[model samples]
Target: MNAKFMITPVVFSMLLLASCGGSYSSNSSDSTNSYGSNNNSYGSTANDSNKNDMRSDSKPMILTQKDVLETVKSKINSDIVVMLPKDIPLSSDSHFLSAKTTDAPDAYQVIFYETKNPISVNSDDLKEASKATAIATVSGKSYMTEQEAADATGHMDNVNTGMNGVDLGSNITGYTDAGAGSTFLNWAEGRWSMSVRNTTSADQQDSIDLAKKVVAMLEKETLPAPHQVGGMKLEAMPNKADGNIISWQNDKTDYTVSNFKDPLDGVKITTSFTK
Candidate 1:
């Protein structure tokens, strides 16, 4: 069977991240973003001399069920799980923006989340908003050696600079920025990159508390696999009306991505094939 998995926007974002670097968006309009580039190991150098074309005739990459399965399998080992506290009175619109897994010998998975809590925002109440809004992203990576993992983390220095460093023991390390009202922290549980972040005017301590809660919740929760419809195990995503999201279809299945309370479980797949 000649099966081609249509590229959804989520998958496209993952591909872009791999080809380029990661990108982040926020609800804060006045927020200033910065990322550091290294010239040593993580940095790149320019080669002035050019040679003959070494390009080969390669077929366009097509995603398949096997590829989806392997990607989901890599996510099963991720040490991160996003679950907001019941007492926080969060918005029902909390959602997982995108998730992707790639098997590059060093298999890895990345998931992004956007969450918000109901709060009273007054123009004079706080700096940006009266409530807490954040984007929590987790990346589970497998490296060929411990040295590779160590080298990859070096870029984090640029991420944590100017923020107040928070020491949550040896396993968890992070920083809190009061000016930006953001808390960023990540821990390496083996090869997995687990992170918890809070971007709000809430206290730095609040961010730490949230991080602890996430770590505790993740200890008991396992990432859910993609949904299976008919005989094909397709990647399940939420529904969004904004037309900003991407949609895809295979010969047997079609996926319309959207925003929901949860990425994996929030949006229900209701198709003629699903009974």
Candidate 2:
């Protein structure tokens, strides 16, 4: 399966500009918003504090509402594209998920994703897609799996650098184009997943919205896409968790640490890792 981080723009109507006053076009160069009184960086439930379900830690993470807000706040101001929340822990039996907003006052981009075990793939590694997988067809590229989409592009040293939007990859079939911000990664459904959503960016509203969407999915505990490798309908190893069937990165650290308008632009990069 393919993992993807999405940089989707919030669709708003221009006719409502009189009440809202802004042309929300999808551009990467919009002036960022400030953490002012109108700051919607923190989700309404972000400060609830009582819904503590997965934040348990051994180091006693002193996570205060203010601290969480501040961390998210910094990402909002720094023009970073955060895909998940902060300090999310990864696990084998559980999935970690969160989202940060990247919509500057002048922008409205958001990233979304789920957690899974990272698969190891070498140059010769390739797995077929499954029916459960909802392929995304952005531009003209077809991402059969989420990982293919996640690892497509973006320097995830960490940020909202993956596939974007909901039910996005569903219509994508045969093939699609990778956007400048496209990225791919390997992920498992349960066993390999650990603190899935790693939020680190300078954007907020979009981050919050992404987080909400992820949390909403988490509430239902969405499973990974099933597999059907090599013309065979695989049953996901019986009881084992489902995740990216093909995944692996090279040992060559010659990676390009940068962002893009179309994530596919970086495909020219060659990895040092070989099978």
Candidate 3:
């Protein structure tokens, strides 16, 4: 799986403007409502506690190596064991670290990066001083439907990067934004979504390369056979019409999962086996 950090467009522009040393107008409601008073750009959940965690002046969260390990182990619930590249460095600094899980449909992530000492988001020189860091990120999610993935990515224009050796003009949608010495890529195949961002030009290929590697890995892994998972009893079967299948039925309902090679582009597909 691929992982990328996302910031709102207004937030991105805000950073650019702030970097230019301009102050916001006190009387401007349009600016004050979104960016000034609430700062929704950083996200409403990113309350003062998160800000204090990123800034060095406040009390450190004091995470240990074991704490990081336990946090990762506790959240993982998938059978697929995706691996990242070898060279990405690891650190425990709160400013450059994050790990969490999202629900409704299950997902988990663990990310770590190393930067210079005394990292501070509020510092004037953050853009220049923290340009280089070793970042490693891993994420896994299971979606009940394609629309769920679409909702998360905001239905952005998906582009074919040809990173996975698919045909030209494949419909696999994605988003890419490059600026401030950084680049980000996000794409999905079926119900699975992946993202990668690189601030250091040196590691720009890391996300792309890892994405392809993951595609290759999942393509070869064994399928989840029909069995009892969570509380449902799934049964593995073959459908000559729809191809191979793993299905579940409980009196009133039925669910099926299957894989197919997307003819438009060869991005390995595991999708609901709908007729």
Local accuracy of candidate 1 as per-residue lDDT tens digits, 150-193:
44332132333434666665455555433364444544332233
Report the C-alpha lDDT of model 2 over 20-87, residue by residue, as the tens digit. Answer: 44334533234344432234464434443344544543333433323543454455532222221222
Give per-model TM-scores: 0.24, 0.16, 0.24
TM-score of 2: 0.16
Q: Against the true structure, candidate 1 has what lDDT? A: 0.33
Full ranking by lDDT: 3, 1, 2
- Best by the lDDT measure: 3
After superposition on all C-alphas, the RMSD of every candidate to the true structure, in Å, is 31.6, 31.2, 28.9
> After superposition, which runs of candidate 1 have C-alpha atoms over 4 Å from their true positions?
1-171, 177-181, 222-275
Give the C-alpha miss distance for residue 54 in model 2, angstroms. 32
lDDT of each: 0.33, 0.25, 0.37
